[model samples]
Target chain A: MDTATKPQQIRLSTTPSRADLEALKIGDIVYLDGLIYTAREGVYKKVIEEGADLPLDLPAESAVNFHCSPAATVNPDGSFNMGAVTATASFRFSKWIGPWIERSGARIIIGKGGMTSKDYREHFVPNGAVYLTTVGYGTGALLGRGIKQVKAVHWNKELGLAQAMWVIEAANMGPFIVDGDLAGNSLFERENARIAANLDKVYEGTRPAVLRRFGETDDRTDEVIG
Target chain B: MIAIETIQETAERLMEKAAIEIPEDYLDGLRTMANTEDGDLSSFVLQAMLENYEAAKQDRRAMCGDTGCPRWYVKMGNEARIEGGPIALEAALRRATAKSTNEIPLRPNRVHPLWRTDHDNNVGIGAPEIEYGFEPDGEWIDLVTVHKGGLFGTDYRMLFPSDGVEGIKRFFLDSLVAFGKRGLACQPAIIGIGLGGSKDTCMVLGKRAACLRTVGSRNSDARIAAMEDEFKALGNSIGMGAMGFVGKSMVVDCNIEVGYCHTGGMQMSVHAFCLSSRRAVARIHGDGRVEYRTDPDWFTDYQRRESVEWTPPQSLSKSA
Candidate 1:
């Protein structure tokens, strides 16, 4: 494998259009600079299921919504003390992602882990959007460094931080990878399949030692996915 | 007698510390991975995490946004008595949890199941799960709090008597391979494998192993210790990096704890904790002295050893 000694620095607009997203291929190391919005769990459900409009006016093409519920402390004066902010697993919010993309015209979805392969093939690819994973480390550190301001907070009292919208301005932020590109490619799905294919051989090599310990039959199927 | 108020204060401090600090051994493991790894992205990510930890410590801020579900493992001294009595300790712990949520500004993650109400305080029915154990003749009450948060699902399993060690290994690897695809289930994850207990016991053991054990610490049983070594090697060999980017270090440690089981069934569980493993420990003396600790010292008795690196095959293919 060719090793990447240094991450390629590509600057992306905070608000990316469909064409902007489609231009970006899988595996492009990017540094996002501009404004991004935080929305997850509650916001997605409310906008898609409860028929509420997206709390912000991010245009579809350049819109970037990170799946995070920032741990921001509200001051007595109603300001926020933005604390540690990081991404959560995206698949749990998979159902609402497509709808949010549709309604809000969001072009990029960034979070930890990744979306399902089906979401990549059907929703992301067709919508001309890409799924990116936050660089796992220093997410909170990035907030401390990259975030210049919390532009606005919406629906603060009713939903609190859990469902509130925080418009944030960031600079030279993100070393995010395109785990799922607009071309129906998924780095996550492909690696999993390759690893699964090799499991039998690995198991076969260790079968004898296992048999010696516990008298087990050879006819066994391993199903990992529920 | 330790006053209930003192216990409450200690519990609150414990929760706050766990939210902010990464344990020493776990931090050491991360630094080792960051320094030794050849992969660029993985190294960068690891270094970034280290930087984040330092920043959080200096700012007195939580290390991560998800300040997780509070899982408390309490050790009660046989001779210990509290001003409000024994049952009051639980109440103190609960109050501490709520107080920390507001004080530390922990994200309110606890949601009511049926009504979909967000308990903005991280408190609800049965919140801040407490598991208690008694230590005879001990002089101080000790508390170890593990804050659990991540996206990967299903942590427990019940094995049939027919399924052997091979089956157990397969389950562990398979679950990993699947979760790895859906996003790195917190890379360089610490996997706690519990074997042979009743289902419930196995689940608890699995959690304890993940939360309480030090990285690179071995099980007391030689066989289980050897298994820990083997699993660590096998897991890293898969080449799943920090965030599924394909690197040499996938699992930092795999701790296995086993218990005797009924003949009818062999129960097992796997609890996976991410590299940002957060926990804290505290001890309160009968004389009102309190000592707060970052290291749980869960594996103090188990010997620590150098990590053995596994080389992947030359023909290894990566997706990225």
Candidate 2:
């Protein structure tokens, strides 16, 4: 219901005491203000699993990391020529959200494609963190517009520009939908159930109809998963 | 003979164009869909997508950041010889890709698998995936440059010949549903279904079909064309509206391309392109005359459905 309503603007930052992420409900569109760290698939493994010290200094608390491998070219000095920087698909990194939150004190993980239940309910619920979904394609570029400047970068040579970590100050940095919230709600899970129920009605007894149309008899049973 | 420099130059131009240019059909389709979609948010989202397109065009930036994998589909003429033969085309393409990396300022997407590696210019072993087809008795080279988003990477499977058309349809519908579940691919997605071929061949057709066919194009085979029509409605009905919002048109079209396969087995691959489907088409004559076209002409041979009334299924969100 909140998703269908107007979004509120909230500025979250490194100071965990300043804002209550838990107060944010699922589906509330929030304009994230201030510094948001950019990391991707490999950064989690490096920091959480592999125990590689964070290559760059980060906020100690209430930190937000976007799951993006930005297409940027860092200049010879340090400034980045921001190319089309978009969010990488979030499903693969869903497994790491919980650990990253635990290890890094990150209160928000911004990405595309809401995370699955494994992380959303199991880890995020207890951790007081949330997964925010943004437009996977264009908005990432738009977010680049809000980035006042790139403060620092890490592992540029090893991960290249895309996978590298860039600490950027983003002002009004998002029109992000709260797909997974600290309230134990998941927009994807809700949508999935509705669609599955509809599929049942649309294709009820589809196998038999298919067999008849193809002029084939059921000879064997084999498992098929989409 | 077509000079290698001409091929290289043409490839460079195509890569640059494909990154920044939204094909005419796609531009038209987005405007139409933006206007047709039911809600204000959906329309607003589509408008933002269009604005992003305009921003990319004016700023000379990539339409969407994904920039995807750099892929070129070449239809080489049998009679049109190259300066260093057909093998030289790959070299030309590679050179073009490097140049375009700086000019288009493409994202360096190519990375190492096992160890840490960055190709720096979006070039590595097997990068800039080039697939070729031979066209007999022609004097020109036709090239289609497509930039695919990372979301709908590629999915392929081998089904028994006994699986029948229904099985293929089920597989496609099921995949479409799963792909849209999280709205990662970015709807009004374009899907290409390739049926009946070896695994690799099916993937090639699937990618080409996904990239080349304009939204609303149909297959030549009546049965296949019907399948496409069914998919278009079924996909929209899933209620995965634009950017996973609540609206009807999740996908603009489903293009089906089929090829003959071994008697006992059928291989199918499904490839998807996101809403910002970026592609360009170009042709070079042996005499060095170059012509660029907006359409990929992939469906030139397919028999298109004349008129089909679309009846979208109930939106899943409405019931929710």
Candidate 3:
């Protein structure tokens, strides 16, 4: 690796401004500060589908929403024990992301395995939000250390620990890579294109399976996720 | 007789170790990849993972928040006896699983598939699957716990003998490319390939090959071992690295396991044990001695025996 080309790292607020996001390139490393909250399918379904009011102020409280399920537990005394924090795949949440961003006024969506550029163009670019991916698909323990405190957990009884909304105070919490940018450019798609250029040569001697499955694509450029 | 209390205690410790510690084999493998990896972003991700493991151990936290599904692989010597028997042994394992989930602060990942019920503990119906195997001699039981990330980077296919190894290679490449994009499979992982076996067993064999086997280990058969080397190289040549970046560190190692399947079918499954690659092992002797190690040392000669009638190896017979 070229040391000269080392990714530039920056720190930004959880409630980042439009300029803060616009200056971010697709591969810049980002560390976050201020408040962030966890929400996934359960929280999305609750607020967007079931028509329940959000338990807290949206972008006013925290513009960042983490697609995460921490290795956490609530003690008998009711305090939270958050050990490791990592993101789930963001592509799975495409259905509700646009609506959630619209409703919450989020500027940053952080998770693993970023959504497609189409997703970025449709949901995020219009909403003035960007996608940041957790490095290594995670650096859970490191991320855990960045969490200054667990401020609150909502709907633990109703949605369960993995699905509940967790409000947290963060201090330089990251190692996240900017996967989506203001222009809706995707780092992953760029990498995929580069990788796809060689698939033909690499796959030379092999033949497809004798049996075929429904909806399987032979196109190497296509993504498994929508 | 092996005490059930000892089994429970040992299991709990194994759980913590699996969650927090990066086994030496996997660590060494990753270090090698790190040294060779040249893609800037991919290299950075590898470096971050190296530090993550250290932080996990130093702070006594799980390496990955998605701690994967906790499972048990118990192997007993034919002569081994438990104080309270198999039923008691299972209860002990389950108790340890639930207790350690809370103690280690593991994400309670298991839930009811259909209704989406969460126990808040990893324990649920058939959650931490316990599989069994036996050796011909001795009075000791080996307990292995593997916390394998359950999603992505695994696939199965049915092919006929006519399709041959070429077909196998195609499926292998397809799986790697599909899941390797954006690092969904959590690449530069140990790739396990299972060829032959009934469909379900193919999946099991591939998973065990990924989770149970250590890096650099190869199949016992000479031909299969050769294929393992070829597959590892083939996967790396795909020009993808950690996080699906442009690089050549895709596969740390490839392990292939095979079983007899129906003559008409060649069932294949591919599994990738992610960057965390969490597995821990311990053996408990009847007289109360315990030893712990990272390598499960699964797939012994006896486990892969090809004959209908079992025969003790000459060395084993002489020792007996």
Chain B TM-score by candidate, in order shown:
0.89, 0.87, 0.98
Compared with the true structure, what per-residue lDDT tens digits does model 2 show for residues A81-115?
Answer: 77565677677776677777787777778877777
TM per candidate: 0.86, 0.85, 0.98
| Interface RMSD (Å) of candidate 1 | 4.2
Please write out the lDDT profile of model 3 over residues B1-320, one tens digit for every residue.
Answer: 99999999999999999999999999999999999998999999999999999999999999999999999999999999998999999999999999999999899999899988999888899989999998888899999999998489999999899889999999999999999999999988999999899999999999989988999998979999999999999999999999999998899999999999999999999999999999999999989799999999888888888999999776663112
Q: How are the candidates ranked when ordered by DockQ, highest leading?
A: 3, 1, 2
Candidate 1 error regions (>4 Å): A1-5, A17-23, A60-62, A156-160, A193-198, A205-226, B297-320
Which DockQ values do the candidates obtain, in the order shown?
0.34, 0.30, 0.87
Name the candidate that leads on lDDT. Answer: 3
Per-candidate Cα lDDT values, in order, are 0.72, 0.70, 0.93
What RMSD value applies to candidate 2? 8.0
Clash count in backbone of candidate 3 = 0
Q: What tens digits encode model 1's per-residue C-alpha lDDT throughout B1-320?
A: 88888888888898888888888888888787777776666676777678788878888888877777877878766788778876798888888888788787677788777775776777888887888765544567888888887757235656666667776777676556555554446777788888877888888778778888878778867988999999888877766667655566677788887777898777778877876787888888889899887656543321122235433335431200
Off by over 4 Å in 3: B316-320
Best by TM-score: 3
